[model samples]
Target: MLKFEKVSLTFKTEGREQHVLKDLSYTFETGRITAITGVSGIGKTTILNLAAGLLETSEGSVINTFAKTAYVFQEPRLLPWKTALENVTCVCGDEKKAKFYLDILLPEGSDKYPDELSGGMQQRVSIARAMAYDAELVLLDEALKGLDMQTKDAVVKTLREHLKGRTAIMITHDKSELEFCDTVLEISDAPISELKHVNR
Candidate 1:
């Protein structure tokens, strides 16, 4: 489980201060898929960065009990020189599972490099890499932004199979993606509100 206790984050840009979150507290339940929804610039990515320990909070603490975590960002962030299969195997060293996920996400182009594939295909490769990492917690921020409806549904299905008994935290604007999540958290000027709750 991940818990944020009175977390406050502030950014200083151009010698000015921007307050993002002021003493916000929340807990992400375990063994569930949680989706964070909000408009652009509502500090969604900031929350993911803080959860991943990539960013520092001005005050308060973030408690993360999970052992391993894999984060998939908005961009593919793949090595331009690496092929799709190499990208997946680079993290987990499981070539068999890497090939399996790539076959499901990008059946025709596992051997292609990042530049050789389309934007959506590259995003799919990133998703496959995260899934192949086999981490206890998976963090995805706009990870499926470029895919078409059919491709998004297929990739969501693939992710669903791997997410069993594990935790997934995603930040997505696509409403269809929420179908796979056990809980949806909406962020805005107001406090976070639960959109749709599902019992597991």
Candidate 2:
């Protein structure tokens, strides 16, 4: 389970304070997939960072009980020198299991380096790495931004199957991506005072 209690995050830029989240409170229930949607630069990714403990809040607290967590950033962030298979295997250290996910997400270019693959393919490889880790909680930031329709369909299906009974939080700009989530939270307003639940 993940809980945010009156969480607030502020950053100082050019000697000026910028508030991203102000007195925001929300709970991301476990064993569910939650999708967060909002305009760019509205601090959607910041929320994911806070959940992953990658950033500290200026006030309040974030409690995450899950033992293992995996994060797939907007960028593939794969090792440029490593092949697709190696990037996934490096995290879980299980070639067989890594290949399992690679086959589903990157059937064609598992042996290709990051430079050798296209942007969409590289993003798929990142997703495969996270899935291969078998994490209890997964945080995805625009994980499907650049995929073609067919590839997106395949990857979405794979994610739905693999994320069963696990906690997942995804940030996406595309509304079509919300189909795989159980709950959709839309963040608006400067400083992010609250999240409005969008029924689907």
Best by lDDT: 2
lDDT of each: 0.86, 0.94
> If scored against the real structure, what TM-score would every candidate get?
0.92, 0.97
- Candidate 2 has its poorest 10 consecutive residues by lDDT at 172-181
In model 1, where is the ten-residue run with the lowest total lDDT?
190-199
Residue pairs with backbone atoms closer than 3 Å in model 2 (clashes):
none
Q: What is the per-residue lDDT of model 1 for residues 1-200, given as tens digits with 9 covering 90 to 100?
A: 88888988888999998888888888888889899888898788888898899988899988889888889999999998899999999987989999988999999999999999999999999999988888888999998898999898898888889888888899999887888888988776732222334443
Distance from true position, residue 45, model 2, in Å? 0.1
lDDT of 1 at 175: 83
**Winning model by TM-score:** 2
